[model samples]
Target: MRLLWPSLAVVLLLYPALAEEHNYQLAGPAPGSIRFKWIHGSICAATNRDPRVQAVMYNEDTYILRENIAIHYDAPFTYLLMGNKGALLVDTGATEEAEYYPLRATVDAILKRWGDLRGKTDLPLTVVLTSPEYLSENQGYRQFVNRPNTTLVPLDLAKMKAFYGLTDSWPNGTGRIDLGGRIITVIPTPGAHKDGVTFYDSYNGFLLTGHLLFPGRVMISNDADYVASLTRLKEFSAQHPVKWVLGSQIDMKFLPGVEYMRLIRYKPDEHLLQLEPTALQEALATATRMLGKPEVAILADFTMRNRVGPDERPGRRPANLPRIPQLPNLR
Candidate 1:
């Protein structure tokens, strides 16, 4: 009876890890759900007083945050991942002013709450970027300056290469950060911008694509470079099971190849922010089609813009939109 009780206790302690391992083997990783609704902008920007940031807790340790469209037009998404040893903050955001956008205060509150729960007073934080060249994706890097126990990562390719210890084989080689038990693989993906990167989380199977594969007009800095990056992602996803491909923005509507126009304060029926592995496959297939000719490829989930920045006037429609009759209000 004495031996039986000790054995039972051991089994009880090991059960969760063993079950998680089994689940991972069966599917990608333990799948999580979106717990919060996204904050699309309003028609009247001045009247919109929603919180500057919308936060969703994917799980106890993983959080997804987005700047309100009213706060910044880009409304880029950021992530917070906590592990036993430390935590990583992905993308500072599009805003720098605390008065207008309170990302720093919001992050600090989350950190304090997590520290209290984990019973660790001195938790370290590492700040990183998704797309270094995009101002909207990295304007908030300076917000973490002089923050206690926080490391602000560099936004340039050279410094980032050295910081991630990828200087040996940069832009082609992979880098990683061992957040205690949860390892994050940083894959260099510099097509959308010169220093963009995609993050893969081992713990939850999240593939953070940054601006590379968002549900919108995906502008390419270099088609060849973009193709190489997409190929890298395809090879990587084949080896690792990815539960979700979270992107930086949501510009397309639920309808196929239909996107919200630029500078529109209110976005009606914005597309789901989360995408599946199939979307990545489709993106690669489409991007490959635009190798030499740089024409726009209007795909169901995304539109591939061959150039960077605003390539067209705000409301100018693309070449080949599906011919669906408009609703009463739309017409």
Candidate 2:
């Protein structure tokens, strides 16, 4: 699933028009288009000379790492939150190519750089996935599952509930995890996506929503649960000043209404990385209105599609669906 240079050119040329047609706000060519250097607030293309994982500093204590689109079309973004005691890595991305997806190496480099800057050393890293499905499906997880001073927390509802002291509250409970000087609230959100959870970074005022509300298709497995989750999310957001709503994937293009191709690894005109709280409010409103209505509803930014019957199992893809063709390796 590698993208060659020539195919990359084709995608760059055609994406703008496609994005415009769908009303996505086009943000020209990605950063480093000419010289391929890391640029803040731009999707920097990856090269052999540079590591596949590109880390962009969101703030002094937080870094957002995105996998090169050429390596995996999904190109999911991971969050690294630094604290006085240790660091927390949100998700391990969607790449299985060990050579291309060096998540652990990237983390080590970032930690070293951060340590040098702050005079801190040997900070433990705790890796937690939005869902356990990522462990078996994403090869990126392999890089950190056995590393030293790293703890890979499982995405078990019961275990997490107990650890966070939310056993009494169960699925709808909120638990607090103190990472040294930083404190984050973990809210259990399990319906929109199985084992789905949201991490609220109080210091940064950022809501890290994993698969609950991204810019693409928000698949609702259970309508009742989805409604409850969104209601809780909205109420929680109202309590805090949410700076931005960050999600794992960006399916919307830079243009307003355009969506990226599901299988394309590279997104030249991707939407802005962070979504405002208003977007979440709108989504919550839409979901609230459709509480007892049909299972499927379409919104401007995302589609509310429901999965029912026997196919609701996690990691199960419908049979006979056409597979997206992978571009051959150009290098």
Task: Pick the TM-score winner.
Answer: 1
lDDT of 1: 0.81
- lDDT per residue, candidate 1, 1-331, as tens digits? 9899999999967653221111122234655688556878888888998888887788777889889888787788999988777889998788898788888888888877877666656678999998778888888888889999999888767898899888887678999987777789999998888788999987788889899998988988888889999999999999998888988888888887887887676776888888888888888888888786646777777888775355543334555656667778854
lDDT of each: 0.81, 0.68
User: How many residue pairs clash (N, CA or C atoms closer than 3 angstroms) in each of the candidate models, in the order given?
Assistant: 0, 13
Error of 1 at 305 (Å): 1.2
TM-score of 1: 0.86
Who wins the lDDT comparison? 1
Instruction: Give the worst 10-residue stretch by lDDT in candidate 2.
Output: 17-26
- In candidate 1, clashing pairs total 0
Candidate 1 pairs with clashing backbones: none
